[model samples]
Target: MSTATLINLVRNGGYQVRRRAVLTSRLLQDEKRPTAACYSSTSERRASRFDPDGSGRPTTWDTFGIWDNRIDEPILLPPSIKYGKPIPKVSLANVGCASHIGKRKENEDRFDYAQLTEDILYFAVYDGHGGAAAADFCDKYMEKYIKEFLAEEENLENVLNKAFLEINKAYERHAHLSADATLMNSGTTATVALLRDGIELVVASVGDSRALLCRKGKAMKLTIDHTPERKEEKDRIRKCGGFVAWNSLGQPHVNGRLAMTRSIGDLDLKNSGVIAQPETKRVQVKKGLLNRDSNIRTKGHHRYLMQVALPT
Candidate 1:
């Protein structure tokens, strides 16, 4: 069988989430093992017991508060299955807190895998500002965009640009539906990574929130932070009709609020010519390692590669 077909078979066998529609009986039965019935029953009972009202039944919304809900959540896997090659794994953790000045918590952050093929794992992190609408939308819809884009793309560079543009359009459409009201003013900062076969890592970023590559005890930044105070960023902001205000510490900010010079969702900022669009960078991890391939290399190099190869 082809790799794609094998992956589809595995997904049909219960390894993936069905996005187009609810899983049909035939699909479920093909995937289900005898133990699935017992596991499902236990899961249902657990969910019921955790229902807020103490009822024996739990609604779909109620499942959000429980950890077990992840089990039923859709799993994104690569279209191709690696034969004799182990699938690369990735793990991520994120924490977001409300800003001290805001009455409403407008910032939202998410890390999700958009595509998982045998050779590549595509993931992105979006940090929203101004309001939660843009960020929340990114969290919900960016992955879908990535998957759709990748299905038709073979080059990583083209895929990155296409996905980003799609995200931009999606945000704009969502904003326009509100008659150019509150949500339109909101925007997000994005940083994305494409991990390829433990050999190459490509990253793109707009605003802050960074991706770092640690190899052989040395740390290297994968993407530049687009801060307003930087000379280039400052010039760009000014040329775009945005003013960079400086603080006592000599740090620059846009409207005395944000520090970054680029982002995704800020329509108000974009109007001033400060784009939220990200700059992209690609790095070859294996190439770097090969360049420093020496017996005298520190133990940290091995540790770093091992850490990167295995998900958190």
Candidate 2:
């Protein structure tokens, strides 16, 4: 009758009838305390349906779980990209898990790629809204666009911008067919980080999904949340004939629905002139005497020094 015992029984798929009987008996007995605990145990069992072993090992049911074990894969570099002198050691980790709440079977969030260089580490988080079509498409094609842009473009900033634009165009192309109509209204929030020289960092974002940079023993945000409550965001929404409304929590949102002002895809919103484009910003990690002067203190001097810049 204990929670742990009930969980074990559920995981082994042997307690469904017993669990129902216990709940029914508790309800009929009018036992409030026992009934509440029974309901709580039932909820826990339902939540753990995918991981019957209770090992915290993610199954395919957990959308964000896709990256859990795959982070161990060896890094493969493109032959065309050259490594810079004094290459820095690099490592990357990513994990995406489905939201515990909301309807099951749909993973609104998508992550496409993770890349690291001597000078930069790139990662992206995409939160899809409306449906999975646009999000899945971005998950499939966004990295390819970035790689291709990098191949032809030298400047990192320009390459990143063009990559996003190309992704938008590709989504639009796919949306032309009636069969792919779901993609027309589906969109996602994107947040990306580019760590440069292991010191300077650049973050680009669209919509409300966030990116946080922990630097110098403190959490520093690199990108602003483009929400409808902000004056600029509100103005843009109004210009597109969209209205903003506050939620029960007093948070302003676009058309009383979405919180972000920009996103990729969401063809229905875009058709109303609300184009979703990423906002990009760069941060410099100063070193040497400049570090002390700029208030960018560090734990150790040697640790703050640039180790190496890997060739791209």
Candidate 3:
């Protein structure tokens, strides 16, 4: 059987959030507190969760002592291995993640991966623009939505498509309830991939975050950027009475606004042809063709790298 690995790269920076989607409300509200007050403890200084040093490890979710839901460990797969299911094993030692704040005040990108079912591995990267709220929303709920849809759907592409649209709608409702009009403008790019039965690979994406597969020393792109640069996307925007305008940076944006034609949580741009429907691609992994010599890398703002090891 072929083994697949995943790497997530966020445009601004990429970090893992171990918390569930239900915490979105509380987490957003907590952002208003002072930097010091954000920390859960005031006594001893806690080491950074990403630090390689083993000293001063955090004992609770408050370990980061920051408003962001950053966690060092990956959310692990369920006990499917014990049930005798043949699935690809991702080694903690071989998987690593990194992020940088850049010139921005905070990282607006989010990425994560998990084993959704005994036969499925999930990976995703989200890039937030206007605000991190949209990115944060997608980060927390995208997987959950996919998992839920998977229970009734057999097609990965269909599941991903539904997940994106549903998440966008949910974010709109969330913003409305919060009474935050600004959130209506918040939006994010989503790139999600699923590996099932250690061979079937399906990827769905909206916006520009990209997924690349490296096999036999050659790199293959798995998704396209959903921007005005694409003829169909630009045409859709114009048909919806939206104009594509270029900024001083020479980048094309929809309606003189969002750079990507499709995204999640850009409720304000919905009428302008910016929809959350994702373009999907499916590939079948051949045994021995994808092994330790192969790797998968995804990018948004920052890069997350993954290495794969498959037995011959």
Q: On a 0 to 100 scale, what is the lDDT of residue 136 in model 2?
A: 78
Clashing pairs in 3: 10-301, 10-302, 11-300, 11-301
List the candidate numbers ranked by lDDT, top first: 3, 2, 1
As a whole number from 0 to 100, the lDDT of residue 7 in candidate 2 is 90
Every candidate's CA RMSD: 22.9, 24.2, 26.3
lDDT of 1: 0.59
Highest lDDT against the true fold, candidate: 3
User: What would the per-residue lDDT of candidate 1 be over residues 151-209, giving only the tens digit for each residue?
Assistant: 89876666777777778787888888777498877777777777675445667777776
Off by over 4 Å in 1: 1-107, 287-312
Expressed as tens digits, the lDDT of each residue in 1-312 for candidate 2 is 999998997876756777888978876665343424334454343434466444345666533443332323233333112332122233443222233324546656655435644445666667777887777777788777777876677666776778777898888888886585677778877666565544455667777665554445465655677777668878878887888889999987777766677888877777444565677877654432222112211111011111112212
lDDT of 1 at 119: 60
* Candidate 3, residue 182: how far the Cα is off, in Å: 1.8
Model 3 C-alpha lDDT per residue in residues 165-258, reported as the tens digit of each score:
8998899889999977889889988988898766678999998888887666687889898989999999999999899999999999988888
Q: Give the worst 10-residue stretch by lDDT in candidate 1.
A: 293-302
Clashing pairs in 2: 64-96, 64-97, 83-311, 84-310, 84-311, 118-310, 119-197
Once fitted onto the true fold, the runs of candidate 2 whose alpha carbons sit more than 4 angstroms away are: 1-87, 93-105, 116-120, 196-200, 247-249, 285-312
- TM-score of every candidate relative to the true structure: 0.57, 0.58, 0.68
Cα-based lDDT for every prediction: 0.59, 0.59, 0.75
